[model samples]
Target: MQTKLTRFSFIAAACLILAGCGFALRGDSSIDAKLQPIYVASDRESQELSSSLKRQFAINDVAVSKRRKEAKLIVIVKLLDEEKRSVALDREARDAEYALFESASIELQSPDGTNLRGPHTLQQRRLIVNDPDNPVGEETESTIVRAEMREQLSIRLARQVEFWSHQLQDQP
Candidate 1:
């Protein structure tokens, strides 16, 4: 019985490792994956952008350390707006459903920092925080929105990566 249990445990561990448990996980080993240790500009929005990019591309997708000379790409995202608008307004400008709009200009570059993909501004809009400040169900909604934005950003970044990757591949 112990032997059977031990064998099952081994199999389970193997499966988990093969599944990429708790390690760098990229959608694929694309050019973006090869360009590890990328640099992201310092800021909250940039942080989110970096985190999201890492998720889609690879862990440590956007390196924050300046001393890290190995970093090839430097991505800068400038926040344009973080506004709240009334969706369903009352007689006055009070007590109404609100919407949040966020806009940023995203730029990706080569190792020398030449423009590879954007400066193609992307905008993300969503509804206001409905759940006061409890921070419970807040995650569910925020996660959904973040996931959506991440998908959009990934598609754009992937296209850029593919373009550069193809260029390099065609060189020789």
Candidate 2:
């Protein structure tokens, strides 16, 4: 009984310390009420990022507007650019590993077109093994890596937006 009580007391103290330091879990972050009815605008090539952002906003209970006219805030995600480069070579000078780079620009603004946060660029990279003998296998691996990179980029973008929203809320 003494051991159980001590353990409980330790946990309670830890929770209080964490809360006092303003540390919050991911799901505990909330959006500002004034930033509701957010409009997400993106080119056709950025559909994946736009969709991912929309899903994240929904999860955070932020209102997403399908039309720009109905929005108080606008988030623009530009089309993604992808590049492939050889990063490593075998003794024979052939490609042994390749790096895939993907990047996109994001901007946050209000209805009046005033910038709120930034026109920031977010980038992601992944290294893939090169299998010259099996072209099909190499292509398949590249596709999978690109998809994974996209998901990671989306998560990072969501986190940045969340931080910026909190900053906005903290303003005087």
Candidate 3:
């Protein structure tokens, strides 16, 4: 009975400590009201990133406007590029490892086209060790990694918008 009580006490204390530090789960990060009704405009080649952004915003309970004119804030994704290259070679000169790089050019603007935030470039990279014997598995792993990278990028973009929204709120 004493051991069980001690375990309960420890768990309660840990929870209190985490709360004191203001730690929150990733999904609990809330979007500011100023960024609601946002429009994400992306080039045809960047549809995946656009979809990721819209999903993130929806998760945060923010409505992503389908039309640019209906939104108070607009996120423009000018370009998204993906590149892969061999980083390591096997003994027989075959590719043993690959470096995957993805980058996007993004800008924030108002409905009137006034630049709110810069034309910034965000980049993400991953290194994958190849498996010559299991080529199909390697391809599937690469695809999953790319999807995760896109999700991470979407989170980053959402945080940027939240920061900008707070700054705007503080302005007179």
Candidate 4:
């Protein structure tokens, strides 16, 4: 009886050691293994964000205008601000350039049939301003700021999605 007890104890210790080392199967990622498709409305920034997400995750993209898209992960982005403040002046004391801060707000909802609405976020920020002296007009400067915001927002949303995807893999 003592010999059998000792053998069981050794086996249990070895199993614990293996578990502590994070030895688990790989195929199982998140409780919902089913590929939850992602879809987003076109708000310039959303378009960029959707493209970025598509590249990162194996998700199907659907048009927001389509009724079925409502069932999947839907995201909408609102261009919050695109302001520029005079940071410095030229030799003539003219408003040489402005320190621009670009901010965007996003709404993401993973519906009931698939995944519930996530943390209600997906935001991005960046500073962008055109060369005020490049002879570019105010319109051109505005365009540059919008473009920069789109690019930066795309990067931030992609990173957040990747992090969430990894979290899914670890949990039950």
Number of the top candidate by lDDT? 3
Candidate 3 per-residue C-alpha lDDT over 1-172 given as tens digits, one digit per residue, 9 for 90 to 100: 9999999999999999999999988864465666678899987988998899889888888888999889998989754679888999999787799988888877889899999887888888899999877889888999999999888888887777777777777778
Error of 3 at 91 (Å): 1.0
Please give the TM-score that candidate 2 achieves against the real structure: 0.78
- List candidate 4 stretches off by more than 4 Å: 1-33, 42-71, 113-138
**Per-residue error (Å), model 1, residue 74:** 2.5
For model 2, give the 10-residue run with minimal summed lDDT.
24-33
Query: TM-scores of all models?
Result: 0.51, 0.78, 0.83, 0.51
Give the RMSD in angstroms, all C-alphas superposed, for model 1. 8.1
Q: What is the lDDT of candidate 4?
A: 0.53
The predicted structure with the larger TM-score, 2 or 4, is: 2
Clashing pairs in 4: none
Please list the residue runs of candidate 2 whose C-alpha ends up more than 4 Å from where it truly belongs after superposition: 1-29
Put the candidates in TM-score order, highest first. 3, 2, 4, 1
Which residue ranges in model 1 land beyond 4 Å of their true spot?
A: 1-29, 32-37, 59-68, 91-93, 128-172
Enumerate residue pairs that collide in model 1.
38-63
Candidate 1 lowest-lDDT run of ten:
59-68
